[model samples]
Target: MTLPLRILMPLLFWALGLAHAVAAEPSGKVLRVLAWPGYADPEVLQGFSQRTGARVELTVVGSDEAMRQRLLSGRGRDFDVFALNTAELQQYIDQGIARPIELQRVPNTRRQRPRFRELSAIPGLIRRVDGLTQVYGVPYTYSEMGLIYDRRQLSAPPDSLQVLWDPRWRGKVLAYAGGTHNFSLAALALGWQQPFELGERQWAPAVDKLVALRRNVLGFYSLPEESVQLFMRHKVALMYANYGLQQLHLLKAAGVDVGYVIPREGALAWLDCWAISSSTGDPELAHAWINFMLEEPASSLLVSRQGLANTVSDSVASAPQVPLRWLEPVESEERREHYWARIHSGDSPSRVLQR
Candidate 1:
């Protein structure tokens, strides 16, 4: 007494359709994202998800170049959001990979700090061949290269970059090996005028100084976690690191004794921003996530947990230690290019490996 085949098939189809109708409904849904290690933590994502029912998938990337390669490989749309440093965004905008952000749709945009808005939304920051203005990114955090040292190893922290080459500190210092950010900051401490605006003539002396320092370096580290680990293990006494607050918090939590100092010459500041992929299919979801991140509560959590400044104004009240001026817009491309070329010449062997 089984039911007829046609009737059973139709009933089964109806049941399946009903089940899909119930399951496909989403309160909030987000796609994958690429970001730096400490930029977003599990609790931060959980808070957003709990509030909006949106699920966030995060992929940690170490460098801007790695993010670029991932996006350019034709799967850019796989992620609804990605984080890029301001310098990296310049290249992304030039390549037409980043889509313009419509702040009007995200009301929380008003919550962002004035400096963050001024830097990211500035008209000429990312110029295009067309006359249209493209605001393609939103800054999340700002960092400056500084010295991270072991309080137990050094009675007094070095005051300037020159100590990197001192015979006493030789084989006890570490630095970033991949980019010119740390090197450029070090050059500034060495009396290089206009540290971020070097010319060919200005580079020779900088290279010589860097080469000498490289000779004395314990090793070059490519990742912050590794850098911290080295310090924890007493592998090196001092290293060039991003703003100390974040690392300092982690080290303290791990029961490691460390301290950070901003050299007298000042430091090279960098801003990391979030941008939607031009290829993203779910723009609404992406916009929602960005807006969610800008909300006061979420922003506060980000600052308190990660030691990164939220881009919005309200976030600043909780993160007063983050210097607002560091978010200032970079100089013209011509000037940046001049410095970029000199610092990235690839001619010096010392630049290849920090001995």
Candidate 2:
């Protein structure tokens, strides 16, 4: 039974298309990662891909919130693991997007500093099920969000978070555009011991402080390189280092004469860690990836090149009086985000807090 020429040709093409698509499907396993830029170095990914049979596919994001939103967009099925700050990891845990880590599988974590090895001591890393504890994230790197000032512009280092509000720095200051850190910095300047735990009464004042900072600054920056560019172009006298010492490293490498200060109120610090996705098909491979990153060479790249402190470092900046206020999960993430939006829209202080 010979078919007509036109129908036979169409049927043959459809069968061939299906065969080609199936053949093009990848054979090797893949370890998908959602991480920050430096965490996805080309050489690191290539080496990881070569070491393990699994290919490494990394998606780089700019901020914690950006990473969170990306994970939510895919409903945890997109990446096998994530590199996120501890403060932001909670949302993923709460949403069941992240899974508890098996410490037995990641023995390299034992090489971490004493402080990092005690995950249960930390506020957010542990959970209990039937009286057995589980760990969620593995602390990888950290930095303190401090103040960076041009030594040439000022003779002495600014000692207070209030310096950001100082009218003296008007038109000469650069700030991070994010709402979270800015609000926290405002709360710190207002002497709130728990800056993230802002009460309704404290909200108005914090909004007012942030509005002041917004009005006085030349512009807000998002990236470390953007801060360097802003400093060079606008003669930015002072900057809130959102990327912490990483920004300072970039600025210094660019030949900027800037000094970093912790201020009297202390700097807000962040601890970024590796977390596994609950929906991942290969938990052991994900664990292997985390263990690989904990190797000495990875820490060396972080400390020597990126100016970030890793978990295994012995001589990290740990002075007792440095007063570093590690960032925590805030009282109401939604409220802070809502109010901070108004602050950025050039709203008057009174109207910004009206809601």
Candidate 3:
């Protein structure tokens, strides 16, 4: 009852091809993700890939400006989903680069805390687009920029932002190298109530203040690990915790004695959220990525590994009892960067003011 040899051979090849196609189906599908550093750890991405048959390509951004440039490139077709602070999310939504989220597709949102569940309560989460109010982002994690001082070097925690400029601590302080946040911090120290909104008169003064800060600091750092190294190696007496509690955790884990405090001028806080790109090729896959981030492992990693407060759980380490000034759209981001470049490069106050 055996078939002819040629006929048998053709059938065998057809069956092998079918099996290979089935096995490679998942490998063919890919999901591109853009997020902040530590937001998408390798373990978390691997979990998503294991549970679903889709591969994840993750891109980690260190600064808000860098994140914006990446998303804006190629009409935002390069990434499917990205994480950004609520304050910075407005510009993307306005440019039509951000797409509305379909809540039903992301059922894991039910697991979020009540404050996050009410998206409408948040100022920048829901926006009117084409005559319809739509949800654009899902809350993920947050932290406030506070001052971290060495316990052995100081009598107690610094109570104000002015401590960063104290002459006694000159050459013994470490500060963030970012322009936007540093400008705001400088404005606050100068007694300006609206730190983010600098007037024409406030610009030169802020620049001069930052110049003084540059001379005072041991050095400027852009990453949490670098800050830790500088703080430990230089015997840094005080630091502007740009990464907030995350930096504190890193320093403590490194065996350094440090204490964190929110300055009386009010700490700048940021709420980072997950959002979809308007040019995403597969909306369903993007939604899945967002949903997966809310799961236990991904959400818990933000707290345990990154020292951030996740939307799904209560924070174990509470921020100090001080007013938290959530970041708002600055008067001009580009202008801040322009001025800060000169200040950071050791430009003189008068020379920097020439522009």
RMSD of each: 12.4, 11.3, 12.2
Tens-place lDDT per residue, model 2, 1-355, is 0001101111233322221111112447788888765654555666666677677776656545566677899988988998887777888899999999998999998899887887876667878979999899998887778889999999998888778878988999998877777778888788888877877788888888888899888989876777789999999899988777787777888898989877778778878889999999999899999998998567777777667778887534443376666667777767777877888888898888775
Candidate 2: give the clashing pairs: none
Candidate 3: C-alpha lDDT: 0.80
State the lDDT of candidate 3 residue by residue for 41-146, as single tens digits: 6678778888777888776554566676777776679888988888888989999899999999999999988778988766689988699889999999887788
Return the candidate ranking by TM-score, descending.
2, 3, 1
N/CA/C clash count, model 3: 0
How far in Å is the alpha carbon of 30 misplaced in model 1? 5.0
Q: What are the TM-scores, per candidate, against the unseen true structure?
A: 0.69, 0.81, 0.79
lDDT of each: 0.59, 0.76, 0.80
User: Per-prediction count of colliding residue pairs?
Assistant: 4, 0, 0
Error of 2 at 289 (Å): 1.5
Model 3 bad stretches (over 4 Å):
1-30, 49-55, 59-70, 114-123, 345-348
Candidate 2's C-alpha runs over 4 A off are 1-29, 49-51, 63-70, 314-323, 344-346
Decoy 1 TM-score against native: 0.69
Relative to the true structure, candidate 2 has a C-alpha RMSD (angstroms) of 11.3
